[model samples]
Target chain A: MSQGSTRKTLASIAHGRSGDKGNHANVAILGYSQDAFDWLIGFLSKEKVEDYFKPLGVTQVERYLAPNVRGLNFVLKDVLAGGSSASLRSDSQGKTLAAALLLMPLPPDCPARLFFKG
Target chain B: MDKVRIGNACGFWGDDPQAPAHLATGGNLDFLTLEYLAELTMSILAHQKAKNPQAGYAGDFITVLQSLILSLKAQPRLKMVTNAGGMNPLACAKKAKEVLDQAGIVRRIGYLTGDDLLDRLPDFIRQGIALENLDDGRPLEPFLSRVVSANAYLGSEGIVQLLEQGAEIVITGRVADACLTVGPAAWHFQTPLEDWNTLAGFSVAGHLIECGAQVTGGNFTRWQEVPRYESVGYPIAEISSDGSFLLTKPQGTGGLVNFETVAEQLLYEVGDPSAYLTPDVSADFTSVEIQDIGSDRVQVGKAKGRPKPPLLKVSLAYRDGFMASGTLVAGGGKAREKAECCGQIIREKLRQANALPQEFLVEILGAGDSLPGIYQRNDPPEAVLRLAARDPSKGIIERFTREFAPLVTSGPQGITGYTSGRPQVREVFRYWPTTIPRDLVPFQLGFL
Candidate 1:
């Protein structure tokens, strides 16, 4: 885990959006640059995402690479409760999962400043 | 061969009603696409057809057509492709023809059939075609009787056939959403059926603008970067002969189109980017590239693809159970605590009466129930105490609906936003995703 000086978040280098596919949800996080993308490919792992979203009952996570877009799409399986038809949650489709994931604290020795300019 | 401009006006059944007229009147489009169906939309249209022989299609297309009449007449070169024919394309096309005739416009109309597979499923089963669920290996046997609507996702072949037959307008049932753009691209470009790269490029473009304003800033991750959302422009993909396209909106319209917007939409609801399977082509979204040339215009390069999958995906809906949700606002101080108490009180009462539903879910709206255990905001001035229940027994759901109103009079001191009364118990038609072999579907195109 990163200390105060090295602590960083995905919001510094990436942005994403999520939606439902049946009961499953896909959260795609795209890097702001190739450097950020390279850092993300190694930093963000399936086990990390599965661990982060475990509180929401995400059974498993499958990571996929989209090098053309410098993005990684993580499919959070069975995380939408029962998806649109049956999920009783306010965001039944897992539309906010990406936003929630972007807030995850990065591992140690990350950049102190945000990577992408506004 | 010149570039083809395709604009999608209607994203779904209940999108902005003003979008059709806005795009039709202003957009210089060769083709206009209206996507009206979603996963469970057919089940609803099926229920409609069961009650009335004359109704099953998307009626709003007729209402929207009335607004597009003048534009369709003015732009004679512009054609329309739509899957607005939910459960019934014939009825929808007939209604559309009547609307056009009334407007004194004589454009050729076509309707495609054979996507509906409910009646044919039994026959396919007899022939040893196991319609097993794509998600799980469960055979359709146990849920056969409960199936309400089953439609195979037809590809662009039928749509292109209709266009080749000199049909100015194309209406289809249960075609893939991307096929709306893919069909027109293949017809206009005259691309070979085996040209998977070209089809993949068009399919990728179609997926971009199919959701209307999605690629042009709707649901964008950087929503703050988008401007003038009140009049957000619909998307237009000016596709070239070589499968490259410029994604933009009508000039002077509101919305942002850039690399960020384009990149986010490329993977919306998609799984493996390398194998984005459709009936037209198995597109590789990973090979697609985008360049933000300027404001409100992005150049999307040629996409890669493989041969189409042997089978077509099926979207089936069946009777799941009855469910209802009712909300009450717990206000002032200690809103979260008060809402929690109200939920406990309801659960206790349900337990005492032995009328507990099979599934009972309680959510405090303002307390970050969206993320549940992850994101939380403990102190809020007010919060919505929502009680939702789903069960096989109609009696259980009906009883669950009654429990909300009683909370207003008997529960916490701050609880008081139940003016809407008890929730209505409605049938839940859960989606069942599966696939069938391409040979099993006989998608036929006919002129009106």
Candidate 2:
């Protein structure tokens, strides 16, 4: 909770492909295309997305996708929760930085919906 | 307690044939366990069962037993347990006993039955146990006709009954993989049923070694760093009465026993870490700790178990409809984009010919530009495209198969791997996994 420790944790997480935020969690959303990909970069790259993440205790965003499989794999860091690993209500670490990554709009008639909603 | 050593050979039917002989001759094993069944394997066995009652079990089990007859006879103290029984444990055991008789081994072979619920289907339905699909939670009524094999994943108690009956070789159907290990532990330690932590430890040990070589490092992500790949050794769980275990492999054998391999098996097919469902116990995988004991050895401890779920997961596969699929390679400069476009083209073609059904789906595989960040390689030089679809209508499925080959001759990628000809349309039997009241389907254990 201290400023110095928060700074160090942020720095450590930022060292990942997805950089770190001061006290918030880090999240990355990988995509199959540029329109949504650009939006994600713009969204996570902006201050509003950063501020929105702080309320839920998110920190940073990183995204990547497999060109061969048409599949996207993401890494969310320092979310209030441990991301998808553990139960949310039970653990404070369960909050995730990649929460906004899921909210980004998708291209019309995209197959990604089948994955997220399914 | 004296060390109870069990060797596992032949992870599946298609596994290396020399594994059993090497393990039997090499290790001072008290028991040899061979696992040869998966959920999909039962369907193939059921297809065989439909033709002949005695034809469902793995034929490779007979071959392995015949090969090991001399070695097994030489070591009278060594026993064997396996679920190679597949859909028909009794038939499999009968055949094994006949083999032993012919070999003059004279060992008392036993068959563990009552797990096969083919005859009790209507009784279970009438009693109001709604068999639902685990993935979708749909009732089993829709695909009941296509049901091929229905068997409960019975625990070690069933296998233990055979040991009590003086059977040297016990054959079972669809028992949980870990149960093979737990049965020996229960018999040895006499651990009470309510002592769940011990059961959890036993289950975890069984789970680690069940896949044969997984815990011993065959499937580790860093397999390249592994010492020996060609002679990769199967796993062995050296358990203690206190419920801790040291996992290792045979001396001088191939494979790595480290943290990574154990972790992979821990995460395999896991739904929840705290409440992993199994027949013997609901293991808390999260609580467990894994550490490398030494070279080719892992120490696993602290796995906790909770009260088991009320209902057992029964995998029942019935005949739905027939369908088949074949792969065609698509390659070009823009293979990823072309593959996606090919999926759309196939569906449009099927719809145009009035062959595509409402439930038709085409999935494209190996499309580059997917997971763009992980690989960090934006444009692959080229990629292979795989397209698959399914439909209830057999004729429609058959019709859709004819559309792929023509795409190669006329489509963007004129060069394709369509030498196999048209895909065969085969029936897709639906699967049912639901819970039945333990009281209603009380297991009847016997030794034969």
Candidate 3:
């Protein structure tokens, strides 16, 4: 699929998973290809993810890179309210967080050619 | 079997009951590992033990073992390692022996002890071991009375010892879930304790398949890509002496095993890829690599690690309060609005009666209640309204559970789906993660 003039979601270039570790939830966004991985290193940032999930009242967001798998793990701090045992939310664990983040619109800065081609 | 073939039958306590038999027959595995202990499972087991002395360990183990006795007899060399011993390994092992003896399959059922630290907390505290909460840094003084379960996560040493002593089935108390594989891999290859790299590799393999079908596409992001998600195959890690491994499911089984599945599980819920701290070793996930070598087989290697951490992680659960949750589905137009109003009506009624819970949440599940503020939808054809509340007193929570029934008749027009009766008030045990020095607790392997 070509990266068109119309903006695409991050799901266009990458896939991910999110799970909880106590009150913190880590989301690993893996690039579908090497080109997408290179583009994501610059396009997706800790600041960007934090701002996106700010409404969830997370305290902090930290990013760790695993180049072997072309993954960027973003740990959202204090995001799960009280976490699994104590959380009152339907998702006591933040299991759907990755799906929520996947909806984010890809910024225009991401050029059309840099998009992943499967 | 130079490369030990280990298959995990079940991940958590309530996982598939038939998987043990399926794996025992179809996997052709040298060892069948069952992981049952979760962070808060020990607390639940503690309460069960308090009621009945022989009720602490996982009951599913006996039932699953009973069903798999013939399969185990056919494959006599096949061994098993499980933390299903929960709060009581002796009782679990005793039950296992009874089942095996009855089936005429006599084997030395080995169970490890000395991991349960509930009784030792005061002694350690008197000796100045604070046993502080790792997350909040709070000391244990205030919550001592409320503490229900306290267990140190033992490493692979106990299981390795049991295996070395010719035990076919090894049961243990709250060892790190990954140690189910680590112990067998270390014993099979005689891997040194100080050999961090190899241990790390074993730990990586263990963690990948630790959650049973997770590595075989249970939680894969691309759900459609997995051929059969419902009846998906359980994972089998064929680990070599060098700690490298290949991950595959039983042949003709439904599921996919590729680099994505391996990579996803490798970092699932792990904070830092470079430092995944388990009791055996702090595995460096970044150094690991996965390659799909055709036919549903994925080879993983190059996992590095540092020496085992001096302090072992501890999970202590203390009774915080009582909590109850109930759900009701509403249909037709404007269901979301009616559900919201009904929840507010219930809370207002509770407030008027002076029994309102301290922590209350009303979630319109279908209308994006899972992610709350992150994802919001306008309205759906029907939505389930969930009411969850927590309070220090049980009587207060008892009052909250009664309100859900009245809403079905008096509140909204299409309020239904309450056939399960009033929600039971459950004692809430908040997780306290901390660490203790490795030398403080010693491991002992005993035969049943």
lDDT scores of the candidates, listed in order: 0.88, 0.63, 0.89
Model 2 lDDT per residue over B120-227, tens place: 877777777667666456877666666777888787787777777777888888888888888777666777766788888888888777777766666454456788
Q: Point out the worst 10-residue segment of candidate 3 chain B by lDDT.
A: B369-378
> Could you give candidate 3's per-residue lDDT for residues B83-103 as a string of tens digits?
989999999999899899899
Candidate 1 lDDT over A23-118, as tens digits, reads: 899999999988888889888999999998998898989999998888999999889888887777778888889888888877657764537787
lDDT of 2 at B258: 71
Work out the TM-score per prediction: 0.97, 0.74, 0.97
CAPRI-style quality class for the chain A–B interface of candidate 3: medium
Ranked candidates (DockQ, high to low): 1, 3, 2
**Residue B217, model 1, lDDT:** 89
Per-candidate interface DockQ score: 0.64, 0.04, 0.54
Ranking, lDDT, top scorer first: 3, 1, 2
What is the TM-score, restricted to chain A, for candidate 1? 0.89
Error of 3 at B292 (Å): 1.1
Off by over 4 Å in 1: A1-8
Candidate 2 chain A TM is 0.35
User: Which parts of model 3 are misplaced by more than 4 Å?
Assistant: A1-7, A113-118
> Which has the better TM-score: candidate 2, or candidate 3?
3
Tens digits of per-residue lDDT, candidate 1, B276-333, equal 9999889999998899999789999879889999989998888989888889999988
Docking quality level of the chain pair in candidate 1: medium
